[model samples]
Target: MIKIILLLFFSLNLIGCKKSEPVKSAEKDDKYGDYYVESSIGDATYLNPILASDSASGDINNLIFNGLVKYDKNIKIIGDLAESWSVSEDGKIIIFNLKKNVKWHDGKSFTAEDVEFTYKKLVDPKVKTPYSSDFEIVKKFEIINPYKIRIVYKEPFSPGLISWGMGIIPKHIFEKGDFNTHPANRKPIGTGYYKFVEWKTDEKIVLEANSDYFEGRPYLSKYIYRIIPDQSVQFLELRNETIDSMNLTPDQYNAYKSYFKNYSKFKYPTFGFTYLGYNLLNQLFNEKEIRQAIAYSINKKEIVDGILLGYGLPATGPYPPTSWAYNPEVKDYEYNIEKAKNIFKKYGWSDYNKDGWLDKDGKKFEFTIITNQGNKSRSVACELIQEHLKKVGIKVNIRILEWSTFIHQYVDKKNFDAVILGWNLSRDPDQYALWHSSQKKEGQYNFVNYENKEVDKLLEDGRRIFDEKKRQKIYQRIHKILADEQPYTFLYVPDALPVIHKKFTGPEVAPAGVGWNFREWYVPYEQRKYEMSK
Candidate 1:
């Protein structure tokens, strides 16, 4: 998952500092008036929601598209484009009652066919969507009427009801095109509150209010996502008041807390975790014992304290501490250098010449860890780990790549021996794409090639289970299994520090974090910066 971005084209061209006098809502009293700007580090790879797996694309898609169901402010599974829904007692069937009179941004009527088309595309083997696992269990898709449909699953799938929350695509536009070259992917037209305006590649993306939005028009006249690559530059833009909000780095948050007193600063646990993933396909990491030894050698608490500066928690396993499925009883590989060395010795890893490096089969134990540039926490964590592991005769090289290049050349192709990366977490705990061995196809989410018959079985069982208590037990077992296996040394769950201009109001903290009620946030007329409120 990725956030939105920023650009230099409009620097010092938009708004004023928050210190400016508060004024009345004379410019955009009736909505369609004010514009809010935000920043993103990486540019969007695809605007097509289903085809896009990165966070930047997902964030933009959330605005231009509407899922059938979404998490409410309190994190409850609630209806969005779907007015209501019902589940069969057996939990194998779900029928959705889509909202009536809903129209796509192109003025086309939204119907059950759109949802059906979206689901079919997801499950199509020809289509390379990472989300196909959720739909593959479907026994069949039944359209009862123009505004109603029933989805019958082969088994009692736990995520089935919430899985329909995938954004619906327009079949009329998507069905006939070369999927990647489709105009809809770049300039999308959806039934959500925001209409796509323009995307200037790496510079900026703009969206305007949709008057025919099912819920009603948004309070802001326009929403702009700017592409500012450097976090420091983004903070400067935040200070200069060129952007309304941006996710702040821990250092930036610490420094600007008092400086941006007039701004609305929010601190909450992001659902995701940063990790060091190993390429199991590589010969160096093919040994599970080597991976387990490395896990015991490093100090995760040191990274949490020294790198994150107390803005996060040491990640124990795949699930974040906040998740109901997170198992606190998983076996932890605490920092122990001697124990790591003992494990290494038992596995035929040793430094016979005392050259301060471990070697086996005449090959030195050395590998590189690549991570995307612009993430300070990740870079720092790698640097610290390099130092920590070097003491144990392990050679680690660090390489930072540009965002787009990193994903396209290294991650998607599984070219690196190791990588320090982050996963944009799913609200639902079905981590099939990130962990399932079958999903290791080219361009798929599970690029690491992690495979265990037990993990696969647990994931399958957990998804098919409808009982919350039962699912929790299965996930807990999976967590313990993964913890013992140590595919990725589960790192840290950083606290998201997003600071927004105080002029924007109506934001409240909740289980879903902020931004769920963004459509309701409005700036008073006197505080409005642009006459474009027209």
Candidate 2:
């Protein structure tokens, strides 16, 4: 069963040395308005919110676009374009009241037609948007008036509003040509706080504040993001003052703690995780006992401590430790080498051959574990797991490939026995794309091919469930079943360390966990001052 945990608990460590510390001016004339940040990753496909996989695009888009609904630091849903909303008695329809005074970057009035058009684009089968599945339950939308919209669903859907919170595109911009090829794609105009100024591929993207923004002009004049793909290199850039901020790995965190203790620093658990996934399509992995044996054999705690170096939290199940849907009552797959061996023997695959390799009908037990390249940490973790499995007489071969080739070949094709990968997580819990029986095949994201009718029903019901407490209970039940099936070994959830220069300051960080809060952040010209009040 696919499970989702829709809670807002974050492990945020507010590490600020002193807010009133003396500011160091590296450059005179105070070009402090230009705060150049760096990213350890690059967007190969610079698409809109519906197409981009990287959270970096989401962060940049937030600055250039306005959604109907937005979340506060505490994840409380607040009005952006939609000022107020009401739900029907049947819980299948939502009526939203939009603000009439808002205007797009191009000076066009923002209205319900724009919101309605955005939803229609996602549901268009020809668009083939990666986010199409998120709106499958949305049956229809009717524009009651220029300032109001009534959305009707096929079934009860509690999370319907937030899912459509992505920035709305003006129907006029898309009418000229396909959004993918339109010049507007590169230079988008939305009702966001900032307007898109320029984008140089693989170089940098710059944004200027919109004076007519509904929230008033942003504090900073301009924001710049320099894209660079190496994490270690990003740390060096931040240290050298070449960039104002970047995300730092745990190893880097320990190396630079002293410098940060005298400045402003913050760390929070990210909405991303790395796990070991098994290919259910493979005949060798079809056996339930074999899957359990692999999951039970490994010592997860050791891998987290050694490879991650205390940077991540051990995953008890598919969800993180902080997730409300985590089933604490469920029995964890603790390390038990003897129990694993016995389970293998009970399944008639115990006896080692003359060469000391486990065999069934004189056939050696072997499989391959794959991982994406570029992430050296994940490759090392896979090698360690290979050694652990070898001790149990199970032959393991490790294969690492480039990130693009790995996702296109091994993962998308379901062509590997196992793989180590990470998931870009969201705040809401909708597991249909990865867990439902219907998505087991096709170009869907469910590479594991896990199928169960019972779980599918629970997920479908949970999607329509309006009560938050009841939805949590349903997900907890689904987590238990996933623990039993063992489609993937839940690894560790890491805390993202986004390195910021001592000069920058901002509002409360977002709980989205992926650190996409650029819209609310600003650099002050006077660095020695306390927090800037909005």
Candidate 3:
């Protein structure tokens, strides 16, 4: 599903310490020697951008690769590998002028052929990727020359330009091997600021700065990604200066606001929402009334207050309030136990045997809700939901598995009754990849098996339209329909609480969040801690 599992942290915590003053030095004075160490809850599943869907992989991919276009700090589409591009008058054809000087990490010259190869691989039937939908609408991909390429869409696909932001893979290295099981999937070669050094499974992944990078060498010499599944353990590492950054849990954000002396904490509303998704294929969840009942029974406010420590807003639909597509008029299912029980009773559920739990067709109203391990907020939210559902004569079981196992074995297989997960959204509002009926196949994002013909049409129409006002209406309608359908009990939009060591400079919070200017971030030679190494 291209699910973003990257831990995002936001609210600024500056209660005890004063903000560090900006360095009174020129650009030439910037030093590049220290390392920026960060932690993730899970290890990356694949370094290959096309095959990788999880956010753990995304974190590393962002450093190791570049797309034709990328989002700037203001959330606007800007050039990355491509220097510029122009769309046809009809908006179907786009010609990109690729950067001529870019070099792949393996020292190969990057050209239009690489971008063309990446597009072909994305639509290739043998490749197992969740991102195929984005490129499937393309009618043609043509390489005009060594540094120029053209893309013709089947129609005026609204997300056509931005979809190229998918990481461009190197054709030279991948052409000889099976793209799915390519050796580079584990150890990738790319044109980004960082070059892959080593990946020790379930432990750490390391990369060194590319001196010949087209945009100029990254000021930070090394980028170290450590896998510490437990948030508490990550916090301990952050406190000891072993790791430079991590997303702080709400409790950690609230209670330890003034604890860190050498760290800068940041918090902002994330563009994602957590949800309780049901397996629609399950007989128990196939009924819309049952899903609605479950939604009504959940106390979303309680989750926001208790687990999030009032750091988040209850979600009513797929888009957060920050999104242009968010439907403000679509009301959420109120937390009402009596309404939920009445709906259950109307749907043939009853305590026929005089037991505390409700039953239908001699089967008890019981189901398990699973989420990834180490995310204490989700586990605690599950406990609260278990209590809420129990009060409504439903028995809810909670299971926490390691991240990779949970996604591959359970989520991808649809071998789960229900799951608590979040979607890291793109700035674009076209949700065809996540909600379309055709996307339910294995390795696709529609893991819940949600299918609605009306939604299918709406998603298609939404992508074909280009006008802002028209597209806004289309997505708003989709939001309302999904809100009423209750395929997922849309949960909350939690504030991102990222904390970073204060030694490095150049991070700035913008509309696109921090880390957009990561290449420019540097530590002064006097403050450098780690030595440069391959």
Candidate 4:
């Protein structure tokens, strides 16, 4: 669930040089120069792809690592490190033909052994990673040679092929130490388009183009990721031309349409949704009716229209409307304060003391909703929900914390009443890590502690079946059940509004957004601005 936001920026010229033209040539030698600078709200916690769950780490990891497989511009599964692959007729075994001449950043050879080591570490019970579920079903991993490998699965896992898309760790570097505390986590060495150069805590992360890259040297000489926690501060930096790229908020996208002439903006629906997930461990939220009542109390349309400024759609379930598994028949709870009040009364929540706040068993009905700081949209949405719930005789409090603290301390530990967060979904519909009852352990995505026997069976069945049609039906059933259960009051799917500076080019408006061909994106020598030190 790592949200990848592509932010490409251009440098402003002080003299009277004309704006840079779009990249039109396919020649790689002539297109290399300049540095692209982007901004992030939080600093990366871990650069190691396996343990990095937050978006900040994901953004950097995408540049510093290469997966065995990757999604193409059309969101189709394609080869990355692997040149090609074949699957058995039973769909339980796969053979991967890895690309030759690939080398890790430290000049070490990348071979089948590295892939095998990464798989072992991923499924190691001692490792604290949420991605273990994806690889746990592997029956056997056999290395045919340095450049070839065969994998046997316990069953026909529908998401098996794409799960190899997880980044491969270098065996030589990680084998001798505790991987969870490895110093290389901050200074990663990967066989990728970029090489990690520096990571200044809470300040910036710098990466240089990998000259020895197997595919080809990247066009941009450097990639700078700046950490600016506040959205308003990020906009100020954008206005001053300090940063080249950012994901503009809905209000910013609509308000600054004509302001930046040298920048190109693209808007598309995101493959994710925001939600208010209740911690089922809390006794207050354990009741299904009370959860449904909370869902009915809030107005999703208000959030989409008011907070999102109509740049999003109200989410009905876990999957976005764009997903094939999304069940259009699953209806959201209508905004009904009276109905919510009735449901609360049925649960013995009432203002017995004539106070506005509801009380039952000598305790007031109240809970705190925690969300990460610097996200204005989620904060405002929480405020709106607080107002709406108060009308239904529920007192609510909101707590905003830093991104690292929010995830590590509050979310992973299950020490909160509720959380207003978002999930950046994968292309495949298998949600075993997020909803299956067995995945409720620490560091797992199922932090809400939602457990349904039917959901567990459906998720298992969905993964074992490969037919798109059959998997679609199973996921639709899951969507319907989750919508009815109300484990999360699914909120909205916002549009991805990313603006890129015009000096750098080669960006396209494809189904996977503009960054799929990032290695090819470049700036002409004439238009080059920032120079990197050796």
Candidate 5:
């Protein structure tokens, strides 16, 4: 049987060789085929635009789905399915007009009813979407006609238009079932440039161009998203030409920039944060002085320059540098060991020899700093912090857990002393879910247990302040207050490194995420020829 199989394979190879001669003899090249993109994360969840968490997935979802209003690279609202909109003077109502020509990838007309259905379905408490909170302030959504809709607000909402960021779902698919676990979620239909083709589990998700798309058919006939679990393996795939593009860490970016000099790279500041959070529920950490000491004790510059290898900026607060509301005037807790010691001493944790740690009333000051496992860099950062804090007679145990446990259990319960985590800030300023006092219950993400009337008021005021300048001022004050309270060790704002093959071009890294202009981006045909020639 083996001999027969080998003989058949050789015969087929011989036939293929004979067939290739005529093509080479003609000296003709085939036209570009498709754009193939690869990344570390798999399609663990389906490509439902409403549910995607990361930027790459979100970008692709946006290509497959159209929001009411899309943003430009500068985050300026541009029309997508919504041709235009009008905001009421009182800021409580917004009316939008749907584009009549748009059609879903499934060939359904994109209508205002879909927009209304999306908001109504998500915000309904029965659905239990984490993103439902994004629309909490919305009171009602009314479809006035097939091409028009009106949004009524519970109160003033500054970033009301940002609601458009949630890709409108087709009412036909998700009319029933909690969308979080819906079967339609696994196979979403949207009115963008691409159509869902097939998902090869644990391997790749394929998409074909939607020729009937309103903006004209995409240049690429197909898009293949190869799923590679490990970052190292993903990079290796890029090197081996098995995959074309992937997001890289700073270290990986630097390594590949040198090794694959011909390849292209798109680096941009992420609208996300990486911070060392204080578990304020812990008795030892409840003290404001101790918290401030811990914040000051962290060498942020070292973490940014040494650990992150100068790929990120020192975080001022929870938000990134490019946020419109980011306040430069806010105070940052600088690295000051003496000051940290002074604060620790004032907090009565000065005794150095009480069971290999600092002590207050015979109690040893020791707690674990938890972070997600499988991240070597974060683990190293935690270890370095553990050593640094030890110098101040404080003992920090590092407890690394899987990503889900870290986020849902440790962070939600506020069970750890400190945590290293990241947050992808939403387009709107309603951070109540993460920062409000009401979210301190277990399974919620208010890790700090931080509660301040003044700060709460500032956040509340900022959310309603439509004026961008006013909002900035409010956030500046809020940031300064948070700095003083020391609820978290504001660490570094890391940039995303998307390593792409030289053959494919135009993965622009904007502030929000990579591929902000994904709709119009095209990989030049010349590179396609080069790839085929090779």
Candidate 6:
């Protein structure tokens, strides 16, 4: 979840030196020099940012693509590609003014046309992107000129401005057929600080700094992302200095705080929560009593303490505790075995034959929790949940699969009884993508298939009512409803434990997480590791 950026201004002077002689300092030689090496547990599925929703793709996309806007270190909305923008009095119209001299990786000028085209692809049903819902609210989309564009919404969309932060793809290259299988997905061309150089699938993705970047030439010459599937293996690489930065596992973070003098660890609340999600379509979980009983049976605090090692808090709802929409007053289901057993008994589930396992109509109460491989915390949490549920006459199993196959074959196909997973909460608090009943279709975020008329209405109203106070009320109701329903046994929100090598500079953790102002991170000449070709 952490990355570094380099945007150092370089001014080279050769008045007193020969071109053949090597200069040690950037001012004497050149600004760009060293390279940054980071590791990921999975390979990026696609370099095209718009087509990607996973974290691995996002890490690489952040270096390769530029959004119209971005978040500052203070968590404030700031301009990136766009220099400035304004909103109409009604709060439905937005006009953007883009920065000049910005170009794509291929040296094509960036303009409002690219912005318009990006929106076009977002709304194109044939393209199939998860971001289509936000753009669907647009009533009018127009490119006023090369450096300007205007958008009018059908209604007051609260997250409209921030939503534009999504990466803007080039119109010149993507204005072709079948965006799903486009060449740009693998070998991309972008306008960010870094340019794509080379990618060996399941191995590494490399990027070189853009000298003609709108900001400035980056100090680092290269950015390398090494793919190491297992966290244990990644930690080994970190110990060996094979990777410069990594988000450490809770156990690893606690165990390796003083492991080395050349590295430093950082801890902060992440915008995510891990949970045990039930397939509502499964007959075993159809009744609210069964779901509530399962929620009551599991000890969130115990899992957070034992698995997270006192590094996380029990999740009360979908939104993180720091989010404005997070309702603290929402009822918390503390662990109570007696209450859980009574609820199951009320729903015709009990150990009638004293076999110590619940059964109804000769069907034993058994299910599986499928989680992707490579995450030790989730696997351990599953083990603990299984033991807790066993005390209540329920048999549980755990299944692990690779990342890509896990999503494409099992998750998207709805071929699961339950799954252990996590969700990164959106900063804007508009969660229509996850909670809306309509989002249960194939390849959508709401794979849980949870449907409630009231929840849907609140989600719709949460986006329409942009006012902070009014929207707060709408989200509050949604939190209460989900907490009561127990659609997922909302487990815990773990702290992100990111560790980086000490040689890198200009990194300061902020409300938006560690990498918000990544472009500003730099490495001093003496501390720079890699040498550039003179």
Per-prediction TM-score: 0.93, 0.84, 0.95, 0.94, 0.84, 0.93
Writing each residue's lDDT as its tens digit, candidate 4 over 1-534 gives: 222211111111000111233433544346766788988888888999888877778778888888888877787777888999999988899999999989999999999999999999999998888898889999999999999999999998888898888889999999998999999999999997789999999899999988888766777889898888899999888887778887888888887766667778887887778899999999999999999999999988888899889788999998999999999999889999999999999999999998899999989999999998888899999999999999988999999988878888999999999999887778787889889998889988899999999999999999899889999999999999999999999999888887888877776667666676777777766666785222
Ranked by lDDT, the better of candidates 2 and 5 is 2
User: Over the stretch 1-534, how does candidate 3's per-residue lDDT look in tens digits?
Assistant: 123332322212110111123333334355656798888888889998899888788888888888888877777787888899999877799999999999998899999999989998999999998888888889988988999998999898878888888889999999997889989999899998889999999999999988888877776789888889888898888888898877888888776656788888887888889889999999999888889999999998888899888888999998999999999999988999999999999989988888899999999999999999988888998999999999999999999999999988999899999999888788788889889999999988899999999999999998888898999999999999999998999999988878778887877676776677777777876777886322
Candidate 2 residues 1-534, lDDT tens each? 111211111212111111121222434433224443545344333436554433446556667777777665565676778889988977889899999889988888988888888888777776634566667788888999999999899988767777757668888787667765577767778777678888887677887767687766654557666666555666666676776665555676777766554334557776556778888888778888888998778888778887767877877666666677777887767888888888888877775555756888888788888875445567777877888787787888999775445655667678888888776555566666678877654335677888888889988888888787998999888888888888888777877665566565553554643334444445555563322222
Model 1 score (lDDT): 0.79
Candidate 6 Cα misplacement greater than 4 A, ranges? 1-31, 532-534
TM-score quality measure for candidate 6: 0.93
lDDT of each: 0.79, 0.67, 0.84, 0.84, 0.66, 0.79
Q: Give candidate 3's TM-score.
A: 0.95
Off by over 4 Å in 3: 1-30, 532-534
Clashes of 3: 13
Question: Taking the tens digit of each residue's C-alpha lDDT, what string does model 5 give over 163-249?
Answer: 666678898888876676887665768887778887766577777767687766654567777665456776677777777666666
Candidate 2 pairs with clashing backbones? none
- Local distance difference test, candidate 5: 0.66
How does model 2 score by TM-score? 0.84
TM-score of 1: 0.93
After TM-score superposition, what is the CA distance of residue 190 in candidate 4 from its true location, in Å?
A: 0.4
RMSD of 6: 6.1
Better of 2 and 3 by TM-score: 3
Of the candidates numbered 3 and 6, which has the greater lDDT value?
A: 3
